[model samples]
Target chain A: MSRESVVGTAEHAAESEWGRLSSRLILVNLAILVAPVVMFLADLAITGDAGLQALITLGSLFVTFLVVSGIGLMRLFTTRYRVTEHSVELHSGLLFRSRRSIPVDRIRSVDLTANPVHRLFGLTTLSIGTGEQSTSASHRLALDGISKADAVELRRRLIEARDARRGYAVPVEDDGPISELDWSWLRYGPLSVWGVGGVLIAGASVYRTLHELKVDPLKWGFVKDLEHRFGSVPLWYGILASVVVLVVLGIAGSTATFIESWSGYRLTREEGGMFRVRRGLLVTRSVSIEQQRLRGVELVEPIPLRWARAAKLNAVASGLGSLDDNRKRRMLTPPVPRAEARRVAAEVLGTDRSLVLRTGLTRHPRAALRRRVNRALMWTVLITAVPVGLGLWLGPGLVRGGLIGGAVLLLVLVAFAVDAYRTLGHGMRGRYLLTSSGTFAHRTVALRQEGIIGWKITRTPFQRRAGLFTLGATTAAGEGVYKVHDVTDAQGIALAEQAVPRLLLPFLERDPRSAARG
Target chain B: MEDVRLRPPRHRVESRAVNWWRLQSLLFAVPLPLTFGILWASIPPTRQIFMWLTLGFLVPGLIYVLVMPPWRYRVHRWEVTDEAVYAASGWLWQQWRVVPLSRVQTVDTLRGPLQQIFKLSGVTVTTASASGAVKIKGIDHAMADDLVAHLTRFTQATPEDAT
Candidate 1:
């Protein structure tokens, strides 16, 4: 059928009409393409250069704008989508002519995103995720810009259709949002690695940009004055002052980012068994995931957050899209009080209490502790050797420095190793298999037992000698594989078999005497 | 303290796999010493140390070439049953993987140039999870084809989402 005829018939039938994108997309495209051209023209006007060089640059800029805007305009005109009984179909491309049809049942997620520009025009971009593993662009189906109301309505219809087809009970309307933004949660904002990391990244980018522009920041009057002041101060005092300054800056930067990204965060369970997360101040995002796809939940407590008794929650779900998208959408709650995080986790998983909060986890064998300490010792020696070697080649001053650093490092590493060993544990709780580990960022992942698809056991020569192995439970959700590290070989095998019964039982051998006695 | 509960998988890979691994290791080990020798002969400044460097690289490289292939052959094994496919690989860092037949998504036979020279092939069984792919390497080419067929038939019989 011709495109025009299809649209005509659909409009007459009042059924499935070929939906066109928001006309505002053309303005968005033009604005993006023209901004740089406008800047270049402004630069040209200020320089008062009207020579042939200027003429060529202006002409080239115009042609580039024409080509880009032409493509954008063509895309805007050709792109059309419609939801049929079985599939969501998208047709686009003027010259090449492409058509894509994703089965309604396979649609895993429907996400709506609106940046500042899109928000200005009351439009949002909709991405329909099919849960395909391939990272190719063809597998991604997105409608660039549509009215916000329309996007939300379309998301509801698509998700509802899938639920209805699957014979799931589709709620008529969303209940009150399960979780909403709390201003007091800002206390945990600066207690994240991102605080220091954000400051470093911003500083580095600023330095690079200044260098690229051929400007020396050190030449600035204030910077030179500060350097002179610092030179007079004692070395230790100057170091302390700098550390204080960096910490303050890092706190400010992280808090600002936290507010900007999560000002009005809301997690709501919509009518069609979909959990929707809506957040962001400037660039708003509304990500929806089918409840059926959720396999479990993960409670993450990074060292800094753990010190503050704060934690974050993430959903372990399938069909959330590529790895990057999956990570962005998996966030169930920002850093909050550990108790609040546990509450939200339980609410999201539709349970009374968070599974990870349960006690009596099966701790790893003492051999695992020995393994960790051995690893820590090996790392300490390897790292200390670098400085020691440099000291030998250089001077006695470096030798003193290396010895001091090595002592401090050994102390820290040994503590970390002990802490890591203490944190290692795995256990079965009802239908979920809980594995908790890591010293840097303790992650307590509660994965549904049935979600486990396969098992991978790895043992190094040292681990084999120690009678320990790392067991990874592979699933289609979240991180794909969650590992329980440094368990005894017997413990690892028993855990795997218990987690997924029939899957590994056939492959395992039992003692003939024990079998006969049983 | 090997666990008596879990035995090694049933079948060893093709015996000729030792030669293929030896050739593969040789390809990796031969170049460094040869390069050092050439540099030592061509460059005057490198003469003092290059001879020692060549020996340092050559001695260990040759020993590794001699030892690794046979050790790897002893370590590598695979088995397929009605319910699951099991594989054990690697020498120093050993791995054992098991994927149920119901979760098998794709079964492919891979033959690299070295493998083709020895008429050996590898069977890769992929599951839904990204990290759940299991490879049975260094099998007879014809046997690999038969294994793939067997796995495919078994997988097709059990209909599930695999996720």
Candidate 2:
């Protein structure tokens, strides 16, 4: 049974459930756009300038409503799919019509997902990905609304096509109960709080920057000459202005965060090796990720979650081909605790319980030294400049500032060394090497024997002289790169040989180099 | 296998192309960075590092042009034999990946400006649990249309092999 057969009949049209779901979305989007219009009207009523201002706000809302309604109508009416004997046909688009037929044999995987709304409405969305590039097809298909019987039958047929091939495992029947971690681990901790705070601050800063950029010559005083610029304003006035701006920004940023991150978070693994993750406040999203698309597990134990015997578990999936692109993304699960991360990773990757890929704990020898030195120097410079900078900020002559700078410089040097020491100590621990050497937010991706796809060992001219080489393993999800900064060629070969066999076995039976020739 | 070769009534073009605007900001590209480097050389923090990294950015593109073998590369012409679909590309060191259609998990097409301009597109063929996916690049649009039709047809007809 290949992916093609899973999405069988191209015969079905927009009948019952799909129509209802699409209409609901149109209504939801309409409600979301109503806030700004109401706010605008209230502002106009208070100021008695309701004519131009209210019209502009109302017009924008109307346009927004039209766009959302248009997309909903298009999906409801235009999008249709049919499952064929050995393939699936999808017809989509409004003006630029498209018809995609994907054979059952070529399908890699099919994922089904639904949110709380989708669950209540008895509808699920499906994403089917194949190994080819076709314009007529979409990676995702919204069933809108369908019976449970139809959904199960679709899954069964798709699995039959996919499993028709040998070596591929039959779709697992027992996804197992939502683990204890799902119930206990998901929490909004300090990092989540700080992350929310950071977003707030950034948003406020952007708003302020835009406001400042809208320089009003008449109100700010027409500045025709450099001498009369705002920089020449009184020192007290400058100090007061800066303080007011900072306070306003700080408050706005914090407020923005409190509203955005409200969560009705839920993570569940179904009986069919599919993980469903749905969360978000005003704008909700639901993603169903196939187990095969699972990339790797990220366990972050920041200061806040650490004390609660907790950590945020983030599963990076493959649908987002590159972090730089792809708006529709999937996560095996959101930030759960650290202890649960390993178990979740195992379930998602379908690896053994003990097989953990350690992607951290290696350093690029020269790069490591350079980073530490740079950090040390920066701290020294900051300390040295502080007292002198304070003298200029406060007054021209202010209390023997040179001595103060020297004392601060000594303290900074001590702090820098301690911070650099912990960062330098980070390294990888798994059977396959993954080196994470960065001083802050250090991460490396290591895979056990099963997770890796293929391994390549290569050395550059400069690296050869330094007796160093890099081993990069391409995973289904992303690139797994490990650089042995100063290891011998023999060691490099030994590691590559040992690792490649494990990685290559599932893909090709013979040695890859010889297989390439054959 | 004999029935698989029978042609369908319609031969449609299958393509997914991302326009040039889809690529990352041009400010990070070599030409823009080089221009910025020379202009900002006198400014603080821009003298040495900016110029050096800007020059370094050209290495990948230069290496690609120089080392790439002049094969009449067409990603669209990729074929799926009864056993496998042969997707191969490379200029310096070559890569040939054979993905049995039975093992295929996902098929994706990407079209960037270079591909869009040339009416070409790249196809990615992936298999379950294996990241050794095959990519075929620089195929013309018309050729891609025929290839996708044949490949999908072949995949449907062939019985699943031991992947």
Candidate 3:
């Protein structure tokens, strides 16, 4: 598709270095050929087709290299480029003519990169991304020998144009000194919450395997064999053996928690009114979020953390997906000292944390009772198994072990009740609504009254009898799951109405006056 | 600041001719892919089937491309108006797009070996959208310079079209 004449105006005849840049296409092809050669060599060695394979491999490589080099050289000869006030034009091709022009406004982002080869030449590749592409492209423009100063100037011009079009005042100078601020780092490290759960599960598997192997005297096979070798073992003795095993497993759970909390940490802060966070180990990521995008803020206080007065804070933002990936998602504050948590929250929400604080949202009486009962049952069954099994295996040696088992069960029950009571004393207080639930890792999430997106209240047959309804509040930031279970239905609806107004919307739309008032 | 080049409008291809080239190029694309596939196929029977299918897809496309071409080099022409660039083409199903000088994102010139041999160039007008992008083939190289200049000046004018 050769044309008869050139299609650009005389002005486009200005100096263009596209030919020098397109010559690098040879290097690109050289990189592409390495893979096929390695594969061919590996195949020849494995298949023992050395003579024929070597000949074919060399021939293919030679042909491919020659073809690539020829194409690149031809492109270098034909390629031409011109920059107009409104656009940058690139004209290149051999048999087929292809020209591309990109307008300044359409260039979404410009990236400067260097590979080892380019670094050796003190050169950089300029890659421009146009957001208009339906599918994301790896690169839209790859220009070589673009000076750093030129890249910066291009970026500045683009930014200025974009800002002017958007009716936003352009900053006087991007690099001019601004107030120095310390940014908090948010890191999700190597050890995560999932790691702790995995360890506990793995340990349980080991315990289960050992028990099935009749390693414990509580096992039926072990008891029966012992009785056959000696006499009938008492039931009380058998119960004692089980208690020791349960204690070992309980310790494993705590150990898992400690190990998992060792890493994967994050820190967030509000600096210059934009929320910024830093996280990662292998590849650190930093995100700067314009504050107006935040939809809402949440404080999640888990059961274990309640005693320590520790809580995790998360912010929901529109356009960004979730707090887990700050690049595309919202940002979350790192687990900070309990004393400083509210201060950070206040900064992020642009309000005094105390203003949202309400009283008495914590573990209810029923939850407290259930936690105690479960713990007591678990310990009693465990602590009594070993000694009782031993007694049973020994026939008549320990007849009083049954009595000890009953006593131990009572003691465990009492201890569990105390612990449950102490834990239930923990509570959440916030302005809109406070919710607390959980036996193992209880959480209390407080939402603001005006921040709710929608509200629903549902009651099951059992819950109806118990005079309890589950209250759900949806927010714009799409916190999909929020159920204040067993709350008064009327109160839940009332809370929702109040919170919807205060709920976060995207920060971009925030009126400074309204935000300040808020 | 780096000096920006400005081209005159007369040298650029009319948008209609570009559209014609696109339709022609699209029509040309059908047969080549089919031929390439057939040649690449290892099975003879599959290759034959592919060759027949390629012919079937190419015939209608070629006829349509030729019958109502978007561009007729002998007749198609463009003018850079004060506010817009008017380009029109087509023997039938005539179509025209008035590119507001302000909306013109880029003006580019291209030359291939064939173009160099024939002393011709191709011009591409890249708008923000893929569907509306225009490419004019077999144009005089001098025309590209004019079109680029005309478009750039138009884009820089007061963006008074929409507040």
Question: For each candidate, what TM-score against the reference?
Answer: 0.91, 0.55, 0.37
Q: Model 1 Cα displacement at B150 (Å)?
A: 1.1
Tens-digit per-residue lDDT, A399-453, candidate 3: 3666576586767676656644443322233454555454445444555543333
Query: Per-residue CA lDDT of candidate 1, range A315-384, in tens?
Result: 9988777667678889988898889888887887877575787357899999989888888888988988
Which segments of candidate 2 are over 4 A away from where they belong? Answer: A1-21, A51-54, A83-85, A104-188, A193-268, A278-285, A293-296, A300-310, A316-330, A346-437, A448-469, A479-491, A502-518, B1-163
**Best-performing candidate as measured by DockQ:** 1
User: TM-score ranking from best to worst?
Assistant: 1, 2, 3
- Evaluated on CA atoms against the true complex, candidate 1 attains a DockQ of 0.54
lDDT of 1 at B151: 96
- Could you list the chain B TM-scores for each candidate? 0.93, 0.57, 0.50
Interface RMSD of each: 3.8, 14.7, 25.1
Docking verdict class for candidate 3: incorrect
In angstroms, how far off is A332's CA in candidate 2? 3.7
Judged by lDDT relative to the true structure, which candidate is superior, 1 or 2?
A: 1
